[model samples]
Target: MSNDTKARMIDAAIDALQRRGVAGMSFTEILDASGAARGAIYHHFPGGKGELVAEAATRNGQDVRAHMAALPGTTPAAIVDNFLAAVRPVVAASAGGGGCAVAAITVEPDGDALRTIADTAFTSWTTALAERLGATGVEPAEAADLATALIGLLEGAHILCRAAGTLEPFERTARAATELIRSRYPHQKQSR
Candidate 1:
């Protein structure tokens, strides 16, 4: 099997995890979503669905980490603003939340290893976010806590928006996250 097939399978697995959670995500759905040869599943992921799910969840977390690293701005407030600017349009254009893959696995990890993977995914996000905030004048310890709060706000916003089928929750979350940064570090004004 080609690497392309493996990547597609992983991507499909991520989608399944987000939409269906671990208990509901199925190999059949992964294969159908990916358009990968059924036989390729075993060839690509010998450890089976659990292994595939773990990899997908990790990838989802890393994808967001990469996005945060690339967000524009050299200050906390600006970072928050730029990040919101990038995601707001996508959130508005979508039918609703994209659903968080890591959270899906987190809520229903099938095994101890899967649980660890979920924790790693969450920690990866906080660590990446903390690094960004810390670089921009926020104290390291405060940045870490702030990062966790911001991520918590984001996840809560996603759930609320998905349930309500509206962007108002996200708008509130964006404002809240921005206000939070402002309150915590009133010294770091928006760079843009």
Candidate 2:
């Protein structure tokens, strides 16, 4: 029960962070969302709201990293497609209201701890993508560059999708990213 409550709180925190960001996410909101009781906040998160948000950010990052690590193909296109597919449900579930939790948190005021957590999460994602791309025969430097660009593209697309209240941005980005990855492997026949 204790672990369940903590997990619930973390899940709620992730949702709150995605939807409302750090300043907007309140203990009351988390409590209400998680139904974990008012005292549970301090008990589960000794560092208070900041700690909760940071942990939520870390959890979200780890989830993405795990998904990327588990992606099924060795080709760049497959890797990119699988990655975009992994995040599609998240964007849809939020109704395009929220984007990457780490990206959302970065918009808030800086705190070394929060920044460090966010930076590590972002780096982990890029590194994972770069590794996948390198495995597809892309040069190390080029793979890193493409991975960085893909992140930028997806993050930007998320922002645009939220603003427009549509998934068109994400869809367009997915296609473009897949194409970009495909272009990197001119010898391999492209998959539709």
Candidate 3:
């Protein structure tokens, strides 16, 4: 049950972080949301709420990687669309009422250590996208650059979508991104 409690707390933390930012994040709230005993917090995270939140941030990053991994795509352009497929439901489910957990950590005050984790998470995500591009015959350096741009557009879209409580930002980015792939990787047929 110890493991279960830890998982619950992490999941709860992620959900809370998404909707409520760090200021509203509290151990009691996490416990209530997770349905875990009070002691579970201290027992599982001796470093306190910060530790728990950091873990949740890491989990958030890993979850995105996993989601992207599960998507089907044989080319760089396909992977871009696959990324859209992976995250579209997430934004829709939140109805632009929430933000990414890792992003939340990066903006938190006095969160240097936590920010490092977020940085690593972002780097990992960028690398994964870059690898997809490279596998589709894009040069290593060019692929890395393209991946960064793509992720940047996606992140910016997330912010805009959340602020507007609509998916218009994503829709716009989708068009722009599709045009990007089509223009740059003309050899890759539009499989989607």
Candidate 4:
């Protein structure tokens, strides 16, 4: 298959994983969504759905990490706000149709390879957040802990917002997370 076809398949798989979870995704669905030829699936992903899904999940995680790393701010509050801003559109676009790909995959019993991808993605996010927090003077250990909490807050809030069919949960969690991060750096101006 051509590289375009392969990339489209990956993109389609990511969307399917985010929207429907692992059990819901199928070769037929991917083919329909991507508009790739049936032969492309085997050509691109000889290992079948598992390989394709794992690659898609890994790419999603990397995209998230890159987004976090590129957040344009020097302060924890600014960083947090930027992070929320970056995520808001995605959640809004999904409109309760789906949620974070890593979160969705983590909860499903999709075997060790997929689980490891989810774990790595979560770790990448947490590590990026922690590094940003540490740059703002939070101790390394405390920043790590807080970063993990922030990830949990955001992921849980995403699920809650999806379930409730409203953005209120995510909004509330974003505010609380900003406050928590700001609290750690009390000297910074509070303008979030």
Candidate 5:
């Protein structure tokens, strides 16, 4: 009911969602993970896992948007490079071993809530990237397409990296992304 409690629930849900695919997850698991009682989960998410997941998905989406908004650039390629750099520590810390929550949930069967969240997050991320791209002279729709490609590459790379337990997949993907970005905006300078 309280803002803090709601935030805690979302945090716990995010952790659980990341670790377990949506449908396979349970209310008991979330309660145990967050150390909250059934009443808390009910009070915050009466519809149970689906509601929590939807909220979690929105939270995650907002996080990505925040990162994009916080960027100091007016260029699409620069924003993406910064985003990738920001993600590097997370990937390296896990030894490149974890698929993205959005990507994972998108694949699981009957995880409509999870899938919706994933789709929304990815869409928001691409939208943010598209804004940056437009600032750098890319047409709005073209920027959106570019943003989608970048996200797809990043998400797919994360999955591969996790499966291989190696950073090579990520590095390779980053290299290709950099190249694609450069080819698309040859005159644009890369952010340090």
Candidate 6:
């Protein structure tokens, strides 16, 4: 039941972000929409909306890392494919309302908090893939670069695909990413 309440609050928070783009989301709105009282939210997230948003964003980042970690192989191409596969479906279903959490927070006025949250989330994600890349013989520097490039491409793909209302943008982005990986990393290509 406690877990359920937390999930509900998180869901409400994401909905608030989706509808209002973060700037307009408030504790009152989240509590009302979540059907959760202020006390309940405060109990779960005492730092209020910033805390809630940070937690929600961290959870989103964790999910992204978990999905990438679940990919079949250690190769760069395999990792990218796993990520694209997971992302395409979610983005398609969201119809663009589920924009990147980092992107959403990038608009916030406080540069320090935004930097901390974005860096933490991104570092967590990059570190996960960097581990896999190391296992596949990629150098530390190359792994970091590859991880950064893949993330940038995926974010761009998400924006373009959602804006176009078509999967073509995603497909094109995936193909280009795959080609880049293949040419640079020489991984066996898997048909998408």
Superposition TM-score, candidate 2 onto the true structure: 0.91
Residue 8's lDDT within candidate 5 is: 79
- Candidate 2 lDDT by residue in tens digits, 1-192: 998999999999888888878888889888888889888888898988888888899999999877766776667777777778887877664455776788777867667778888899888888888888788787899888987887787678777888888888778888887777677676865442
Model 4 lDDT per residue over 94-148, tens place = 5577777777677666487778889999999999988987877778998799778
Query: What residue pairs are clashing in model 2?
Result: none
- Evaluate all candidate structures by whole-model CA lDDT and list the values in order: 0.79, 0.81, 0.82, 0.82, 0.73, 0.72
- Give the Cα-based TM-score of candidate 1 against the true structure: 0.89
Per-residue alpha-carbon lDDT of candidate 3 for residues 1-192, written as tens digits (9 for 90 to 100):
889989999999998888887777888899999999998888999999899999999988987766654556777778788877777777664455887888888888888999899998888888887877777788999988987887787677768888888987788888888788878778877664
Query: Residue 77 in candidate 6 has what lDDT?
Result: 69
Per-residue lDDT of model 6, residues 73-137, tens digit only: 65666767776677777666444545676556667887568657778877877777777766667
Model 2: lDDT equals: 0.81
Choose the strongest candidate by TM-score: 3
Q: 1-192, model 5: which lDDT tens digit per residue?
A: 477777877887776666665766677877776777678987988887778878886887788777765655656678668767877765653343444556657876777767777877888888887777777788988988887887777777676776788878778888888778778777776664
Which TM-score value belongs to model 6? Answer: 0.82
lDDT of 1 by residue, 23-59 (tens): 8888999889999988998998899887898889888
TM-score of each: 0.89, 0.91, 0.94, 0.92, 0.84, 0.82
Q: Which residue pairs overlap in candidate 1's backbone? A: none
Error of 5 at 72 (Å): 2.8
lDDT value for candidate 5? 0.73
| Candidate 4 Cα misplacement greater than 4 A, ranges | 190-192
